[model samples]
Target: MSAPALERAQVQHRTVRVLALGQVLGGVAFGATVSLGALLAADISGEESLSGFATASVTLGAALCAIPLARLAAARGRRVALTLGNLFALVGIAIVITAAAMRVFPLLLVGVVLIGAGNAGNLQSRFAATDLAESAHRGRDLGVVVWATTVGGVLGPLLLTPGEALGRVVGMPPLTGAYLFSIVAQTAALALYLIALRPDPLLLAQRLARDDARVALPGADVDRPVAARYAMLAVAASHVVMASVMAMTPVHLQHLAHAGHAGHGGATEAVTLLVGITIALHVLGMYGLSPVFGWLADRWGRVRVVLLGQAVLATSLLIASTWPGERMAVVAALFLLGLGWSASTVSGAALLTESTPLAPRPRRQGMSDTLMTASAAVGAVLAGLVLGQWGYGVLALTGLALVALTTLLSPLGRR
Candidate 1:
């Protein structure tokens, strides 16, 4: 490559790194909220069922706001839309804090909803990273952002320990302190984004597109339909399956213990620990090795990687269904679930980023994320119903069916 070409490549690499760091912080905030939200809700409401509602509310809110916020980003710019998301998160944290102090369930729900909206913004950060990258590195850059998320995600749960202690000192419930910490994390995330994400990747991509136009190759000017939309659907399906299966695991475990399967102990505490570990491992699977998946997508093909991920997820669900009463079996299943999510998410995001021009990047990103979160919400709701009425077996089979559907659609993915 020529000197100018090399320099451009270097700039793109640097831009991707910066965006990845920002994504890490954002992921930390998000991970903290997800890890602690259920416990916090249960503590606040004094009802286990309310935890389901709280989780659903957050996912539902994100789903509802995703496309709209994307449109806002498209019309205005990412900086404004992202800043707005941070502000919403700030408000949501306040509501949760107030709800804790007042012991109001409804108010807490509102807070979760706002936090979900904030998540919609966080999810778009990958698209921003991709906008600044060359096609060859697009998946890799997106994966780097996903990998960055692991740092915050791992630390978020650890914060729970300190947060719980702080809650005691402040005369608030321990779970309330988790939300407070989330506020601090989110505030820092906002600052990082504001300071580092200036100029906006979408705008940069637009400029690149214009530059490419001046030195256009054959077929370069023709608008290629973005493969990201289809990839987004696959990503959403994986998330929904993961959330649905993971959500009901604790309940299923308790039933097993009741039937004299797990072992001797207070089933509740064991179940709680199991749930926490499962979530942490699940998160690990989702973020860890994401870069590898992204690289594979760019190298081998996005659709093939996505199809492989779906197959992995289907296998995990099948395992979970076959041995519902075994703790060890369940843990292994969840681990696979996490891994499948990581692969699909990383690859799917990269596909989305490559599929669109800068002008529509943010809006498309937001739309994809919204669909992703919405599917998870639907899965959560359905999981609750299936687990309550039909049994874990039925849910697993249904998840398998979805995976098959995703596989069938895999051929539609971008090269």
Candidate 2:
């Protein structure tokens, strides 16, 4: 390798490692909030219906903040943009804790939204991983950073028990104990991004571009808007399908668990256990083997992997539709749904990054992430309506149709 190539390679390695650590921290914050936000809302408001808003607030926050953060990266750099995001999350954590203590439901919503803003930044970390990446190994590099999230994601929910115990000892508000850990995690991530993340990958790439004709730019056909448009569609569609299915899995599990039971209230614990286990497994499927799919994306080609992901999504929906009442089968289907989501999302992200040039990439990525989170938010709402009216069978079938449309559109992205 030439001297400059070796230096770039070394920086890429350092960047990925640093970004991975940051992701783990962000994962901890996200996992805790997602797992407990609804429960906290219900406890605060004394209205079960209001509980759903806790989650919606977070999603809304993420979507709302995506564009501004992208613009920040475009103006300042990834370092500043990401640090501000983590800071937003940290401040939000403090507010959540205060709101819990004050018994203010509206305040809690406000805090969670900021927390979601932090998550938006975390999601952008994947793109940062690719800023200095070699085209041949782009997917693999992105996957490793994504996979690092598994540690925080899996461990965060599991810490609820310990968090509760600690909260009691510390005389903290009921479920707000988890947010304490989030505070620490977000703070650490903020520090990491500020102190490290040197030369700012986005800025460095810009310099490299100015120094030489966009040397860091990924694929040859990337300059075309149509190609980038297709890549963005892939990212958006994958999220919509994943979020639509994932958002309703808990409800489906509850229905399945209580279908013919004599007393619905009596089996609450049993149902909770079943739902938690299945959801945990689903999380594993989403993140555990991401590196494998990332490798596939690199070797097999990005378009093919995305198409394969759509196929997997179709099969999962079929299984879910065919055997909605069979508990284990549904569990298996949900797991597959996560796997397919992981494949499509990771590959689609890599594709999107490569398809856009360095100068406009930051804003474009932000637009894509905004579309992703916003569409997922909409899909989750629609899925709830479908599940409530038509049932799980119809919801799964509905998702299957959406996946088919994505598959048909996949050809447009192929080079």
TM-scores, all models, native as reference: 0.87, 0.89
lDDT of 1 at 69: 78
> Where is model 1 more than 4 Å wrong at Cα?
1-11, 42-50, 211-229, 250-272, 391-393
In model 1, state the lDDT of residue 311: 77
RMSD of each: 3.4, 2.9
Per-residue error for 41 in candidate 1, Å, reads 4.0
Which stretches of candidate 2 lie above 4 Å from their native place?
41-52, 98-104, 214-221, 251-276, 322-327
Model 2: weakest 10-residue lDDT segment is: 212-221
In terms of TM-score, how similar is model 1 to the real structure?
0.87
Using TM-score as the measure, the top candidate is 2
Write model 2 residue lDDT over 1-415, tens digit each, in one string.
6555566778889999999999888877777786677667767988644555666677778899999999998889899989989988988888888999999999999998898898888888999888888888999999999998888877776666567668888998987676678888888888999998997887777776666653544562367666677778877887777777666666566566777565656454454456556766667777888889899999998888888888888888899889988988888997888888889888988888888877788888999888888877777667766776777888888877667777888877775
Per-residue error for 200 in candidate 1, Å, reads 2.0
Give the worst 10-residue stretch by lDDT in candidate 1: 214-223
